[model samples]
Target: MKYRIVEQTRPGGMLAQVYREVLVPAFPPEELESEESLAETLETGLGSLLVAVDDTGRPAAAAFGHWWEASRVQMLANLAVKPGTRGHGLGGRLLRDAVDAWRERYDPCLIVAEIESPDARMVHEDYGDPRRRLGFYESAGARVLDLPYFQPGIGGASRRVQGMLLLVIHADPTFTPERLDRLSGKLLRAFITEYLAAAEGEPANDWDAKALFRAFDREGGIPMGRWGTRP
Candidate 1:
Protein backbone atom coordinates (compact mmCIF):
# COMPACT_ATOMS: atom_id res chain seq x y z
CA MET A 1 0.00 0.00 0.00
CA LYS A 2 2.83 2.41 -0.76
CA TYR A 3 1.91 5.61 -2.61
CA ARG A 4 3.95 8.38 -4.12
CA ILE A 5 3.03 11.79 -5.53
CA VAL A 6 4.73 12.50 -8.82
CA GLU A 7 4.91 15.49 -11.07
CA GLN A 8 4.09 15.01 -14.74
CA THR A 9 5.12 18.10 -16.68
CA ARG A 10 4.67 16.50 -20.08
CA PRO A 11 1.22 15.80 -21.44
CA GLY A 12 1.96 12.55 -23.18
CA GLY A 13 3.15 10.88 -20.01
CA MET A 14 0.38 12.03 -17.67
CA LEU A 15 -2.36 11.94 -20.27
CA ALA A 16 -1.81 8.31 -21.08
CA GLN A 17 -3.37 6.18 -18.34
CA VAL A 18 -4.31 8.96 -15.92
CA TYR A 19 -6.26 10.99 -18.44
CA ARG A 20 -8.20 8.07 -19.91
CA GLU A 21 -8.59 5.55 -17.12
CA VAL A 22 -8.79 7.99 -14.20
CA LEU A 23 -9.76 11.55 -15.14
CA VAL A 24 -12.15 10.77 -17.99
CA PRO A 25 -14.16 8.31 -15.96
CA ALA A 26 -14.22 10.59 -12.91
CA PHE A 27 -15.53 13.89 -14.31
CA PRO A 28 -18.93 14.49 -15.89
CA PRO A 29 -19.18 15.61 -19.51
CA GLU A 30 -19.27 19.39 -19.04
CA GLU A 31 -16.25 19.36 -16.78
CA LEU A 32 -14.24 17.00 -18.94
CA GLU A 33 -11.74 18.46 -21.37
CA SER A 34 -11.50 17.27 -24.96
CA GLU A 35 -8.38 15.06 -25.06
CA GLU A 36 -6.87 16.59 -28.18
CA SER A 37 -7.45 20.11 -26.95
CA LEU A 38 -6.08 19.29 -23.50
CA ALA A 39 -3.01 17.61 -24.95
CA GLU A 40 -2.34 20.66 -27.09
CA THR A 41 -2.62 22.93 -24.13
CA LEU A 42 -0.39 20.68 -22.05
CA GLU A 43 2.34 20.61 -24.65
CA THR A 44 2.22 24.40 -24.98
CA GLY A 45 2.87 24.87 -21.22
CA LEU A 46 -0.65 26.12 -20.70
CA GLY A 47 -1.39 23.12 -18.49
CA SER A 48 0.29 20.93 -15.83
CA LEU A 49 -0.42 17.82 -13.81
CA LEU A 50 0.41 15.92 -10.60
CA VAL A 51 -0.49 12.32 -10.02
CA ALA A 52 -0.44 9.84 -7.15
CA VAL A 53 0.49 6.30 -7.97
CA ASP A 54 -0.06 3.21 -5.84
CA ASP A 55 2.46 0.58 -4.92
CA THR A 56 1.63 -1.29 -8.09
CA GLY A 57 2.60 1.80 -10.11
CA ARG A 58 -0.99 2.46 -11.16
CA PRO A 59 -2.19 6.04 -10.93
CA ALA A 60 -4.63 6.49 -8.06
CA ALA A 61 -5.48 10.15 -8.35
CA ALA A 62 -4.56 13.35 -10.16
CA ALA A 63 -4.78 17.12 -10.23
CA PHE A 64 -4.92 18.86 -13.61
CA GLY A 65 -4.30 22.57 -14.00
CA HIS A 66 -4.20 25.42 -16.49
CA TRP A 67 -1.26 27.70 -15.77
CA TRP A 68 -0.65 31.34 -16.75
CA GLU A 69 3.07 31.95 -16.97
CA ALA A 70 3.19 35.75 -16.86
CA SER A 71 1.46 36.17 -13.53
CA ARG A 72 2.33 32.78 -12.12
CA VAL A 73 -1.15 31.56 -11.47
CA GLN A 74 -2.82 28.20 -11.96
CA MET A 75 -6.41 27.16 -12.40
CA LEU A 76 -7.38 23.78 -10.99
CA ALA A 77 -8.62 22.37 -14.26
CA ASN A 78 -9.66 19.07 -12.72
CA LEU A 79 -9.00 16.78 -9.74
CA ALA A 80 -10.04 13.19 -9.40
CA VAL A 81 -9.39 9.87 -7.71
CA LYS A 82 -9.83 6.46 -9.24
CA PRO A 83 -13.20 4.81 -8.51
CA GLY A 84 -11.87 2.08 -6.24
CA THR A 85 -9.55 4.51 -4.47
CA ARG A 86 -12.23 6.78 -3.07
CA GLY A 87 -12.41 7.36 0.73
CA HIS A 88 -8.72 6.68 1.10
CA GLY A 89 -7.71 10.36 1.40
CA LEU A 90 -5.64 10.01 -1.77
CA GLY A 91 -7.39 12.97 -3.38
CA GLY A 92 -6.49 15.38 -0.59
CA ARG A 93 -2.98 14.02 -0.24
CA LEU A 94 -2.38 14.38 -3.96
CA LEU A 95 -3.69 17.95 -3.92
CA ARG A 96 -1.62 18.95 -0.90
CA ASP A 97 1.50 17.42 -2.37
CA ALA A 98 1.01 19.23 -5.68
CA VAL A 99 0.31 22.54 -3.98
CA ASP A 100 3.40 22.19 -1.84
CA ALA A 101 5.57 21.47 -4.86
CA TRP A 102 4.09 24.35 -6.82
CA ARG A 103 4.64 26.81 -4.02
CA GLU A 104 8.18 25.69 -3.38
CA ARG A 105 9.13 25.46 -7.02
CA TYR A 106 7.18 28.16 -8.86
CA ASP A 107 6.16 30.48 -5.98
CA PRO A 108 2.93 31.39 -7.71
CA CYS A 109 1.02 34.42 -6.45
CA LEU A 110 -2.01 32.22 -6.07
CA ILE A 111 -3.68 29.02 -7.19
CA VAL A 112 -7.37 29.27 -7.94
CA ALA A 113 -10.05 26.73 -8.63
CA GLU A 114 -13.80 26.86 -9.26
CA ILE A 115 -16.33 24.63 -7.60
CA GLU A 116 -20.08 24.47 -8.05
CA SER A 117 -21.89 26.53 -5.42
CA PRO A 118 -24.63 24.73 -3.57
CA ASP A 119 -27.39 27.14 -4.38
CA ALA A 120 -30.09 24.49 -4.15
CA ARG A 121 -31.87 26.15 -7.04
CA MET A 122 -29.38 25.08 -9.67
CA VAL A 123 -29.94 21.76 -11.39
CA HIS A 124 -26.22 21.11 -11.30
CA GLU A 125 -26.27 20.79 -7.52
CA ASP A 126 -28.29 17.64 -7.93
CA TYR A 127 -25.81 16.23 -10.38
CA GLY A 128 -22.85 16.99 -8.19
CA ASP A 129 -22.70 17.79 -4.51
CA PRO A 130 -21.24 21.26 -4.34
CA ARG A 131 -21.16 21.12 -0.58
CA ARG A 132 -18.98 18.05 -0.59
CA ARG A 133 -16.46 19.54 -2.99
CA LEU A 134 -16.35 22.85 -1.14
CA GLY A 135 -15.78 21.08 2.13
CA PHE A 136 -12.84 19.18 0.71
CA TYR A 137 -11.20 22.38 -0.56
CA GLU A 138 -11.94 24.22 2.65
CA SER A 139 -10.25 21.45 4.59
CA ALA A 140 -7.17 22.17 2.54
CA GLY A 141 -7.31 25.88 3.62
CA ALA A 142 -8.57 27.23 0.29
CA ARG A 143 -10.60 30.40 0.63
CA VAL A 144 -14.19 30.41 -0.49
CA LEU A 145 -14.64 33.57 -2.54
CA ASP A 146 -17.65 35.78 -1.98
CA LEU A 147 -17.46 37.54 -5.30
CA PRO A 148 -19.75 36.54 -8.14
CA TYR A 149 -18.42 33.90 -10.53
CA PHE A 150 -19.59 31.72 -13.41
CA GLN A 151 -18.09 29.11 -15.69
CA PRO A 152 -18.92 29.25 -19.37
CA GLY A 153 -21.05 26.36 -20.56
CA ILE A 154 -18.75 23.75 -21.98
CA GLY A 155 -20.09 22.38 -25.26
CA GLY A 156 -23.64 23.32 -24.34
CA ALA A 157 -26.12 26.17 -24.08
CA SER A 158 -25.49 29.02 -21.61
CA ARG A 159 -25.81 27.95 -18.00
CA ARG A 160 -25.54 31.13 -15.99
CA VAL A 161 -27.21 29.73 -12.90
CA GLN A 162 -24.80 26.96 -12.19
CA GLY A 163 -23.23 29.18 -9.49
CA MET A 164 -19.59 28.38 -9.97
CA LEU A 165 -17.64 30.01 -7.13
CA LEU A 166 -13.93 30.63 -7.33
CA LEU A 167 -11.92 29.02 -4.54
CA VAL A 168 -8.55 30.70 -4.28
CA ILE A 169 -5.49 30.28 -2.05
CA HIS A 170 -2.76 32.87 -2.01
CA ALA A 171 0.91 32.17 -1.64
CA ASP A 172 0.80 35.27 0.50
CA PRO A 173 -2.50 36.77 1.66
CA THR A 174 -1.41 40.40 2.03
CA PHE A 175 -3.04 42.67 -0.55
CA THR A 176 -2.51 46.12 -1.99
CA PRO A 177 -4.87 47.79 -4.47
CA GLU A 178 -2.58 46.73 -7.30
CA ARG A 179 -2.28 43.19 -6.04
CA LEU A 180 -6.05 43.00 -5.70
CA ASP A 181 -6.53 44.12 -9.27
CA ARG A 182 -4.03 41.55 -10.47
CA LEU A 183 -5.79 38.86 -8.48
CA SER A 184 -9.19 39.92 -9.76
CA GLY A 185 -8.66 41.07 -13.33
CA LYS A 186 -5.14 40.19 -14.37
CA LEU A 187 -4.78 36.79 -12.78
CA LEU A 188 -8.20 35.26 -12.17
CA ARG A 189 -9.76 36.43 -15.41
CA ALA A 190 -6.77 35.38 -17.47
CA PHE A 191 -7.11 31.75 -16.46
CA ILE A 192 -10.91 31.71 -16.63
CA THR A 193 -10.91 33.36 -20.04
CA GLU A 194 -8.41 30.87 -21.40
CA TYR A 195 -10.31 27.93 -19.90
CA LEU A 196 -13.57 28.92 -21.57
CA ALA A 197 -11.99 30.06 -24.81
CA ALA A 198 -10.11 26.81 -25.11
CA ALA A 199 -13.35 24.87 -24.98
CA GLU A 200 -14.92 27.10 -27.62
CA GLY A 201 -11.95 26.84 -29.99
CA GLU A 202 -11.39 30.56 -29.55
CA PRO A 203 -8.47 32.63 -28.29
CA ALA A 204 -7.76 34.32 -25.01
CA ASN A 205 -8.03 38.09 -25.08
CA ASP A 206 -7.65 41.03 -22.70
CA TRP A 207 -10.26 39.41 -20.40
CA ASP A 208 -11.57 42.73 -19.09
CA ALA A 209 -14.78 43.10 -21.08
CA LYS A 210 -15.94 39.57 -21.87
CA ALA A 211 -15.22 37.17 -19.03
CA LEU A 212 -14.77 39.79 -16.29
CA PHE A 213 -18.00 41.50 -17.24
CA ARG A 214 -19.85 38.21 -17.15
CA ALA A 215 -18.46 37.47 -13.72
CA PHE A 216 -18.86 40.93 -12.21
CA ASP A 217 -21.17 43.09 -14.39
CA ARG A 218 -20.37 46.57 -15.80
CA GLU A 219 -20.89 49.46 -13.41
CA GLY A 220 -19.18 47.76 -10.50
CA GLY A 221 -16.04 45.98 -11.54
CA ILE A 222 -14.11 44.03 -8.92
CA PRO A 223 -13.83 46.05 -5.73
CA MET A 224 -10.20 46.96 -5.39
CA GLY A 225 -8.52 46.14 -2.06
CA ARG A 226 -11.78 44.93 -0.59
CA TRP A 227 -11.36 41.18 -0.83
CA GLY A 228 -11.84 40.21 2.81
CA THR A 229 -14.24 42.90 4.02
CA ARG A 230 -17.21 42.39 1.70
CA PRO A 231 -20.08 40.03 2.36
Candidate 2:
Protein backbone atom coordinates (compact mmCIF):
# COMPACT_ATOMS: atom_id res chain seq x y z
CA MET A 1 0.00 0.00 0.00
CA LYS A 2 1.28 3.46 -0.88
CA TYR A 3 1.30 5.72 2.14
CA ARG A 4 1.69 9.47 2.21
CA ILE A 5 5.05 10.51 3.62
CA VAL A 6 4.98 13.60 5.83
CA GLU A 7 7.98 15.52 7.13
CA GLN A 8 7.77 17.41 10.40
CA THR A 9 10.55 19.55 11.81
CA ARG A 10 8.58 20.76 14.78
CA PRO A 11 6.21 19.49 17.41
CA GLY A 12 2.35 19.29 17.67
CA GLY A 13 0.01 18.06 14.89
CA MET A 14 0.50 14.36 14.16
CA LEU A 15 3.86 14.28 15.85
CA ALA A 16 2.50 13.99 19.36
CA GLN A 17 -0.17 11.50 18.38
CA VAL A 18 2.29 9.29 16.56
CA TYR A 19 4.72 9.38 19.47
CA ARG A 20 1.99 8.40 21.86
CA GLU A 21 0.40 5.71 19.73
CA VAL A 22 3.10 4.31 17.49
CA LEU A 23 6.42 4.89 19.22
CA VAL A 24 5.37 4.56 22.84
CA PRO A 25 3.93 1.12 22.38
CA ALA A 26 6.38 -0.02 19.72
CA PHE A 27 9.59 0.54 21.72
CA PRO A 28 10.56 -0.29 25.29
CA PRO A 29 10.67 2.55 27.79
CA GLU A 30 14.45 2.52 28.07
CA GLU A 31 14.87 2.50 24.32
CA LEU A 32 12.44 5.31 23.57
CA GLU A 33 13.05 9.02 24.08
CA SER A 34 10.73 11.21 26.01
CA GLU A 35 8.18 13.19 24.03
CA GLU A 36 9.64 16.46 25.32
CA SER A 37 13.11 15.56 24.14
CA LEU A 38 11.81 14.55 20.75
CA ALA A 39 9.95 17.83 20.48
CA GLU A 40 12.92 19.87 21.61
CA THR A 41 15.15 18.41 18.91
CA LEU A 42 12.63 19.22 16.24
CA GLU A 43 11.95 22.64 17.67
CA THR A 44 15.64 23.42 17.76
CA GLY A 45 16.21 22.27 14.18
CA LEU A 46 18.52 19.51 15.34
CA GLY A 47 16.25 16.72 14.17
CA SER A 48 13.37 15.82 11.88
CA LEU A 49 10.50 13.36 11.91
CA LEU A 50 9.08 11.43 8.97
CA VAL A 51 5.70 9.80 9.26
CA ALA A 52 4.05 7.36 6.87
CA VAL A 53 0.36 8.04 7.07
CA ASP A 54 -2.13 5.51 5.76
CA ASP A 55 -5.07 6.26 3.49
CA THR A 56 -7.18 7.02 6.53
CA GLY A 57 -4.64 9.54 7.81
CA ARG A 58 -3.37 7.20 10.48
CA PRO A 59 0.37 6.96 10.92
CA ALA A 60 1.65 3.50 10.03
CA ALA A 61 5.32 4.17 10.54
CA ALA A 62 7.69 6.86 11.81
CA ALA A 63 11.38 7.65 11.56
CA PHE A 64 13.20 10.25 13.62
CA GLY A 65 16.76 11.39 12.87
CA HIS A 66 19.02 14.01 14.41
CA TRP A 67 22.03 15.75 12.92
CA TRP A 68 25.27 15.78 14.92
CA GLU A 69 27.31 18.76 13.81
CA ALA A 70 30.43 17.62 15.65
CA SER A 71 30.47 14.35 13.72
CA ARG A 72 28.70 15.50 10.55
CA VAL A 73 26.42 12.47 10.94
CA GLN A 74 22.71 11.97 11.07
CA MET A 75 21.60 9.47 13.67
CA LEU A 76 18.52 7.36 13.00
CA ALA A 77 17.11 7.81 16.44
CA ASN A 78 14.09 5.58 15.97
CA LEU A 79 12.38 3.77 13.11
CA ALA A 80 9.14 2.05 13.97
CA VAL A 81 6.02 0.69 12.30
CA LYS A 82 2.68 0.17 13.94
CA PRO A 83 2.27 -3.40 15.13
CA GLY A 84 -0.44 -4.11 12.55
CA THR A 85 1.58 -2.46 9.80
CA ARG A 86 4.62 -4.73 10.01
CA GLY A 87 5.78 -7.09 7.21
CA HIS A 88 4.55 -4.66 4.56
CA GLY A 89 7.85 -2.77 4.09
CA LEU A 90 6.47 0.38 5.65
CA GLY A 91 9.44 0.64 7.96
CA GLY A 92 11.86 0.38 5.05
CA ARG A 93 9.98 3.02 3.10
CA LEU A 94 10.05 5.34 6.07
CA LEU A 95 13.74 4.72 6.52
CA ARG A 96 14.42 5.52 2.88
CA ASP A 97 12.42 8.69 3.12
CA ALA A 98 14.36 9.73 6.18
CA VAL A 99 17.68 9.12 4.46
CA ASP A 100 16.65 11.10 1.43
CA ALA A 101 15.38 13.98 3.51
CA TRP A 102 18.45 14.13 5.71
CA ARG A 103 20.76 13.86 2.72
CA GLU A 104 19.09 16.73 0.95
CA ARG A 105 18.96 18.84 4.08
CA TYR A 106 22.21 18.17 5.90
CA ASP A 107 24.38 16.32 3.41
CA PRO A 108 25.81 14.47 6.38
CA CYS A 109 29.07 12.60 6.15
CA LEU A 110 27.31 9.50 7.51
CA ILE A 111 23.85 8.36 8.49
CA VAL A 112 23.99 6.05 11.49
CA ALA A 113 21.56 3.99 13.53
CA GLU A 114 21.63 2.19 16.87
CA ILE A 115 20.33 -1.34 16.82
CA GLU A 116 19.96 -4.18 19.28
CA SER A 117 22.88 -6.51 18.85
CA PRO A 118 21.86 -9.99 17.83
CA ASP A 119 24.69 -11.20 20.04
CA ALA A 120 22.94 -9.77 23.07
CA ARG A 121 22.22 -13.38 24.05
CA MET A 122 18.69 -13.10 25.24
CA VAL A 123 15.54 -14.94 24.22
CA HIS A 124 12.73 -13.02 25.89
CA GLU A 125 13.42 -9.44 24.92
CA ASP A 126 10.50 -7.08 24.98
CA TYR A 127 10.87 -6.06 21.36
CA GLY A 128 10.98 -8.56 18.50
CA ASP A 129 13.87 -10.80 17.64
CA PRO A 130 17.16 -8.94 17.33
CA ARG A 131 18.25 -11.28 14.53
CA ARG A 132 15.30 -10.28 12.35
CA ARG A 133 15.80 -6.59 13.02
CA LEU A 134 19.49 -6.90 12.18
CA GLY A 135 18.53 -8.61 8.94
CA PHE A 136 16.16 -5.79 8.11
CA TYR A 137 18.83 -3.10 8.42
CA GLU A 138 21.49 -5.19 6.67
CA SER A 139 19.17 -5.73 3.74
CA ALA A 140 18.80 -1.93 3.61
CA GLY A 141 22.53 -1.52 2.95
CA ALA A 142 23.50 -0.95 6.57
CA ARG A 143 27.01 -1.99 7.67
CA VAL A 144 27.55 -2.63 11.35
CA LEU A 145 30.48 -0.85 12.98
CA ASP A 146 32.59 -2.74 15.48
CA LEU A 147 32.16 -0.74 18.67
CA PRO A 148 31.17 -1.48 22.24
CA TYR A 149 27.86 0.43 22.12
CA PHE A 150 25.24 1.27 24.69
CA GLN A 151 22.49 3.88 24.64
CA PRO A 152 22.61 6.69 27.22
CA GLY A 153 19.49 7.27 29.25
CA ILE A 154 17.03 9.35 27.22
CA GLY A 155 15.91 11.36 30.24
CA GLY A 156 12.56 11.12 32.01
CA ALA A 157 12.10 7.65 33.48
CA SER A 158 14.33 5.98 30.91
CA ARG A 159 17.55 4.14 31.71
CA ARG A 160 20.47 3.11 29.59
CA VAL A 161 20.21 0.14 27.22
CA GLN A 162 23.38 -1.86 26.65
CA GLY A 163 24.60 -4.43 24.10
CA MET A 164 23.62 -2.28 21.16
CA LEU A 165 25.35 -2.12 17.76
CA LEU A 166 25.87 1.00 15.66
CA LEU A 167 25.29 0.79 11.90
CA VAL A 168 26.27 3.11 9.09
CA ILE A 169 23.19 3.18 6.96
CA HIS A 170 24.51 5.73 4.48
CA ALA A 171 27.82 7.42 3.84
CA ASP A 172 29.08 10.04 1.48
CA PRO A 173 32.15 9.42 -0.73
CA THR A 174 31.10 5.89 -0.04
CA PHE A 175 33.01 3.68 2.39
CA THR A 176 36.41 2.26 1.54
CA PRO A 177 38.09 -0.16 3.90
CA GLU A 178 40.82 2.39 4.45
CA ARG A 179 38.36 5.17 5.22
CA LEU A 180 36.23 2.99 7.47
CA ASP A 181 39.24 1.82 9.40
CA ARG A 182 40.81 5.25 9.67
CA LEU A 183 37.66 7.13 10.72
CA SER A 184 36.02 4.48 12.88
CA GLY A 185 37.35 5.75 16.15
CA LYS A 186 37.17 9.43 15.28
CA LEU A 187 33.64 9.35 13.96
CA LEU A 188 32.21 7.21 16.75
CA ARG A 189 33.77 9.28 19.49
CA ALA A 190 32.29 12.48 18.12
CA PHE A 191 28.91 10.91 17.45
CA ILE A 192 28.60 9.57 20.97
CA THR A 193 29.90 12.76 22.51
CA GLU A 194 27.08 14.76 20.98
CA TYR A 195 24.53 12.00 21.60
CA LEU A 196 25.51 11.59 25.22
CA ALA A 197 25.38 15.31 25.91
CA ALA A 198 21.87 15.48 24.49
CA ALA A 199 20.49 12.43 26.25
CA GLU A 200 22.46 12.39 29.48
CA GLY A 201 23.39 16.08 30.01
CA GLU A 202 27.08 15.23 30.62
CA PRO A 203 28.96 12.82 28.41
CA ALA A 204 31.87 12.46 30.85
CA ASN A 205 29.60 11.80 33.80
CA ASP A 206 27.81 8.77 32.39
CA TRP A 207 29.90 5.65 32.93
CA ASP A 208 28.97 3.88 29.70
CA ALA A 209 29.22 7.04 27.65
CA LYS A 210 32.57 7.95 29.13
CA ALA A 211 33.87 4.43 28.64
CA LEU A 212 32.77 4.39 25.00
CA PHE A 213 34.33 7.80 24.35
CA ARG A 214 37.60 6.74 25.88
CA ALA A 215 37.64 3.32 24.23
CA PHE A 216 37.13 4.75 20.77
CA ASP A 217 38.91 8.07 21.22
CA ARG A 218 42.24 6.82 19.94
CA GLU A 219 41.35 3.26 19.02
CA GLY A 220 42.48 1.88 15.68
CA GLY A 221 40.36 1.72 12.60
CA ILE A 222 37.38 -0.60 13.16
CA PRO A 223 36.05 -3.10 10.64
CA MET A 224 32.57 -3.18 9.22
CA GLY A 225 30.74 -6.45 8.65
CA ARG A 226 27.36 -8.03 8.23
CA TRP A 227 25.53 -9.78 11.01
CA GLY A 228 27.08 -13.09 12.00
CA THR A 229 30.15 -12.02 10.05
CA ARG A 230 32.46 -9.55 11.79
CA PRO A 231 36.21 -9.38 11.25
> Residue 114 of candidate 1: its Cα lDDT?
72
TM-score per candidate, in order? 0.75, 0.88
Question: How big is the RMSD of model 2?
Answer: 2.7
Put down candidate 1 lDDT per residue, 1-231, tens digits, no spaces.
778888776678767788787877776667676887678778897677888888888888888877767657776878888766776798788888877777776777678777776554333422335566667787787776555566665653343325577777554443224444333444455555555564544542434325454654333334432224344
Q: Which pairs of residues clash in candidate 1, taking residues 3 or more apart in a chain or in different chains? A: none
Lowest lDDT block of 10, candidate 2:
174-183
Candidate 1 TM-score to native: 0.75
Displacement of residue 39 (Cα, Å) in model 2 is 0.9
Alpha-carbon lDDT, every model? 0.65, 0.78
lDDT by residue (tens digit), candidate 2, 153-200: 776114678888888888765434466434466666677777777777
